[model samples]
Target: MYVPKNFQEPDRDTLFQFVRDNSFALLVTTGDDGIPVATHLPIELLPGPDGKFQLVGHLAKANPQWKLLGRDTPALAVFSGAHSYISSSWYDHVNVPTWNYLSVHVTGRTNLLTADETLAFLRQQVDKYEVHSKHPVSVESMTEDYVRKEMRGIVAFTMEIDSMQGAAKLSQNRDDKNYQNIIAELRQKDDTDANEIATEMAARRVDNGQ
Candidate 1:
């Protein structure tokens, strides 16, 4: 979350889109013992009562991390996008190897959701993920009693977003020649992350009208 000025992404729309694209995020909170606990889950971005954005997700009730919620302290949600290793050899000038990536961090106060609210969230979640399936299943397809029984095993909560920050470290600091070379090198790799980074870098260049 320590974003350099040059790498900082201040656009709210861009950050929100990133969160939606990379909905599976890391949720972090500090317990009463002052130790940090984390959970990896699919978090949805929604507007809260205050008309500001918030994060919604559920955790297994047995997970101790859920106990850390609804506290005075805030929780952090980290949405990570594509990343790749950038070798120094890709640059003409002497430079250390680094990573090129995109990520967004959101922090906020969280509160437990009512059972009805949680049910609604679950239904929406199911629909969103099943949209691409050939025979998409939905919570509505299941009996209400069955769904309610399953909900008993988990805790749902919403974090009203207080702040959001993003970092886009796509070799923007490098010279034009080095930047182009890095993208080319990344694209040559068969790795998914590498190809994604290359595409993001190329897209950013076009966005900046470079």
Candidate 2:
């Protein structure tokens, strides 16, 4: 993630919130052959017993991704949120079209979870996702035998994030006139991505004491 200084998102609170909201992220690792392998996974963010934040996610047992990359290897988790195209016509000055987006990159070491941890991870994920559900389910919803059988079908892993890099390319580099123009143009559209960028831009304006 090559974030320009002008586009770098420095708000630590916003960065973690973005990860939680867009928890379905891409996990990337280099294979033994040095080819990059990637998996699209939904991760649950949790505080470990040791007090460090941990990423909890599972892959299919037959996938072999964990066997190849889950142990003692560097990994990257990419959380991509909203993005949209900014037309040059929306700028006050002559400029080419560009994309505005928000994303977070996490680099860490991955470790396969033990059987006990896998079960615990599943319960936590269900609890987290079903917090608002009327008919919330839990690990106790299934019989012990059934839960064990199901656990055999998946592989769970945890990544303790060592570093996080973030970016939000939201036209902060533009002049006031151009910035307002971009926001107005975005707000005029029905596209969610554009609308999201517009909202962020408006918040940024307030942050800048505009």
In terms of lDDT, the best-performing candidate is 1
lDDT of each: 0.93, 0.87
In order of appearance, the predictions have TM-scores of 0.97, 0.94
Model 1 scores a C-alpha lDDT of 0.93
For model 2 the local lDDT of residue 70 reads 63
Across 1-210, the per-residue lDDT of candidate 2 in tens digits comes to 799999887777787888999999998888888898889999877888899787889999887677765667779999999999999988666779999999999889988889888888888788888889999888878755688789999989888888888998998888888898899999999999999999999998998898
**Candidate 1 lDDT tens digits, 49-128:** 78878899999999989988998899999999999999999989887999989999999999999999999999989999
**Where is model 1 more than 4 Å wrong at Cα?**
none
The superposed Cα distance between candidate 2 and the true structure at residue 143, in angstroms, equals: 3.3
